[model samples]
Target: MKKRGLAGEFVAHLFPRVVRGENLRLTYTFCLGGLALTVFLLLLVSGVLLLFYYQPTTAGAFSSILFLEEQVPGGKYLRSLHRMASHLFLILLFLHSLRVLLTGAYRPPRQLNWLIGFALLGLAIFDGYTGYLLPMDQLALWATQTGMELLGTIPGGTLVKDFLLPDGIGGSLSLLRFYALHIVVLPLAMGVLIVLHFYRIRRDKGILPYL
Candidate 1:
């Protein structure tokens, strides 16, 4: 027998051969978590494609989007894929969370994974919000401004608002900040949380055996 290499060993360790048959059923966990991860990967790829033409600035943001839609080949579809994937990612995560709650998957050893999952959801939402402002259209501007104001109403929210929008929505600095968070900061944080979430699942012996 040929010995497995280090990478093969790691893969085997990550995904053991034995899994509960019930966990494989379509109705077991509904595969919501897996679907969410797939959509996230789609979003990441399409987002990178959009980044090629997207201008993160107060002056050129809207025009850059227009250029992407009208001038670049398949740019509209790429953006739409990213946008739709973002929505689907959130929806799948919400449903997955509901499934977890209903199935009591959050009990005991799995509680940490539950928190990590929710944190990923929150970051995903914030990532969407940040991307929403990148177009610099009137609607995006006003909508993001309204969101910032609402955020400010919460205690200690003003600090977050200030950090995110020091010069107010649509300002050069604010647009830059949003662009950075959307493309860089939030994605990195989400990646970290996703790794931890998966690790926890592996540590907890996977998916709670469908209750």
Candidate 2:
């Protein structure tokens, strides 16, 4: 109780400022932010668990996935959960983008934050594509191959094709690269963008027209 009081007193003494309801965007913005954070955390945890049992190359991936789903107890549940959460994350990411567009939330001081949101949107979709390739099932193989062909038609696709389906791609190697990108590079980039997003919010709030 004493500690609680001291903490509260410290907060009060150091920061007496109050947030006015009208000063912020509509309630929906807060709701959207909540959805974004929830989905991102879901992806992080599920992606980590998936990396434990998955192999990336074409030959072994199918068997490894089957092993996780059938042989390992509770593996089916987590794999299914991960798949569902991924779809949900994409849906909500799209919704968040729409919310910003409709609200004109990118005005003036918020324009750069809007760009960050767009980048996150693209990353979310790319994450889905990368995940789809990890299983190396017939569906994964055909879909990825078709995607590569489609990109191949576009200019400068030679560079893009390397990472999408490198020459040495097989079961274990591709999975490792996919896992590292999903868990390491993409997440790190997302984290940095999220921080920047919040920092910009604080900066904009200072100059925003108060109601």
Candidate 3:
């Protein structure tokens, strides 16, 4: 009883790898990707929690925000966490891409990963934009209005705006569509791209310098 062999002894071997940082590659863009991932996790946790009580309809949206602000126990904390995580994601994504470009890491072999990262960045923006609409308050309304109007100026952007514009309201966007795309499509695409991103890293770049 209580004896150990190769399997149990493996626990002893585990500590040094982590301690010596052998457990994983540590590269500049990879580190930033990890940080962005952490932020995304925070956003997800806080967002789902908010979703429990959030109402996306025009009639209920502002009230839900007030409830979050005034009634919920940790509402402010959750709001702040979500907000901060969103900002951090933007920062981290930018830094990660910039790091790759500056280091020439995106050249050959890794070019597709960089392209995928760009797509993911756009998806992340859409995710944030969709989430922004959940609040459905004046600010979110005005923001979406501004966004769509600006988008309308792009080539074929008018068609895009028409596709997203609300049927019953003159000034509102489609809450259901945006929410579905955010909670479903964009994240799914990002997840796929993320798997490929990591795979490319391992296959092409291997590990970073340990020192």
Candidate 4:
């Protein structure tokens, strides 16, 4: 047999050669993790498309969104798809986490994968929150301000708030920071965590058998 190349080996590692028959049942896993991943992919594509038109500035952010919705063809649908997928991704992650917990899938060798999954969920939530401020609308402005205030109330969270909003609130610098985090930093981190999560799952012998 020909030895697989690096790309082929990586693909094989992700796809795996064997899946137990019991794991095929829908009720066993509810496919929540798979669904979340699908939504993440959707969000990625739509977000990239949106990036072509989005402006990362307090002065132009909301105007650019309006231009996309009213001037760009099919832009409204693309934005809506991304927004809906973001919401669905979070929901699916929560349900998947609950399923893992109830099934005791986090026990033993699966613990590391569980931690990775938890971190991915957190990144997803923060990604959504960061995106919330990119539009620079009144709702987004007040909501982010409220969140920043709440963060200041927590121990050590004030430092985080300061780091994120160094120039007070709702300015060009803060909007740019949120835009960078939403579009670049958070997604890249989540992507890395997802790869590690999958590798851990395979190493741990796949998902736990149904009870």
TM-score of each: 0.89, 0.79, 0.81, 0.90
Q: Write the per-residue lDDT of candidate 1 for residues 149-181, one digit (tens) a residue.
A: 899999999999999988977889989999999
lDDT of 4 by residue, 142-170 (tens): 99999889888999998999889989778
lDDT of 3 by residue, 1-211 (tens): 2434443333333222333445456655556876886787787778789888877666777788889989989898888888888888988988988887888888887788789888888888878876776677777778878888898899999887777775522233487677777677877787677666665564464343221
For candidate 2, the 10 contiguous residues with the lowest summed lDDT are: 1-10
Cα lDDT over the full model 3: 0.72
Positional deviation of 38 in candidate 4, in angstroms? Answer: 1.1
Badly placed stretches (over 4 Å) of model 2 are 1-30, 168-176, 206-211
Q: Note the residue pairs that clash in candidate 1.
A: none
- The candidate maximizing lDDT is 4
lDDT of 2 at 181: 74
How close to the true structure is residue 36 of candidate 1, measured as C-alpha lDDT?
81
Better of 2 and 4 by TM-score: 4
How much is the lDDT of residue 154 in candidate 4? Answer: 91
Question: Local distance difference test, per candidate?
Answer: 0.83, 0.71, 0.72, 0.84
Q: lDDT, candidate 2, residue 36? A: 73
Off by over 4 Å in 4: 1-10, 18-20, 208-211
Question: Order the candidates by TM-score, highest first — what do you get?
Answer: 4, 1, 3, 2
Off by over 4 Å in 1: 1-21, 208-211
